[model samples]
Target: MYDEILLPVAPVGEANDAITHAVGLAERYDATVHVVSAADTAVDTLAGPRTGAFSERLVDAAEERVEAVTDELEAAGVETVGSVARGDPLEVIENAIEDGADIVVMPSHTRRGIRRLLLGSVTEKVIRVASVPVVTVPMAESEAEGERSDAAVDDVGGASGSR
Candidate 1:
């Protein structure tokens, strides 16, 4: 049912759950996984403030992220390849659609109430714009329950990359 899986690696938090899910799907369907991450925000600085040149920081960060994600997928016994590009999620995903990708498996991230209201969900943008079908993995029930605690910030919600 799926061809190429586009797994987006969120900056900092990473997409551990998405990779696991993608690996399982790829194994079942014998599909290729294309781990993609759109460079919407600058991937620089560990926290707090931006440091050094934008190009240097973004490229370094994106490269590291792409390598980590690809390595994780491969380590999980799934064949994978990926690219890091800068642009809007929907635009970049649509632009990166490879020849044999019939479906786009994305881990749509949640922006929460006001942020979502103001900026809109990246998944929403991709879904509205992507030419192929998209698969979304919402936050796990267990993860959601922990949101009320101090660990709330640790749980990154949803995964919506692309295929």
Candidate 2:
């Protein structure tokens, strides 16, 4: 029941899962995938003139991210389009929805406790704001477990046991 699938890609590896999920949905519904990346360019005023250069770089990087994801999805036989926008991430994604996104399929990165509290989450914000359905594929269980295991090991104050 989806006509347009909006896949908001992160600039990091977390996007792979989201891409896989969105591509699968797109294949099933024969829908077009609109892959978008946000260039977070909101910086302090003291940064000044450097902000222009920084924004340009971020936009360029975002474009590359979208292009790469679009190419991969298209190669898999899905119709895909890409766009890069600069501003508050939530607003940029909301604008994509306004542009005609019937649904949004995005990955929810694992941010825990204080970190989650302080940084909030893009997926959460989008879900709260977007009018359309938002399908959030959280970090794969295995991946999340692995990350927790690694963190647990690191948290050990002093591991006297020899490997």
Model 1 residue 118 CA deviation (Å) reads 1.2
Model 2 residue runs over 4 Å out of place are 12-15, 44-47, 140-163
Q: Judged by lDDT against the true structure, how good is candidate 2?
A: 0.70
Q: TM per model?
A: 0.71, 0.81
Residue pairs with backbone overlap in model 1: 6-162, 104-163, 106-160, 106-161, 106-162, 107-159, 107-160, 107-161, 108-159, 108-160
lDDT of 1: 0.59
Give the distance in Å from residue 150's predicted Cα in candidate 1 to where it truly belongs: 16
Off-target runs (Cα >4 Å) in candidate 1 are 41-52, 140-163
Cα-based RMSD of the predictions, in order?
6.1, 9.0
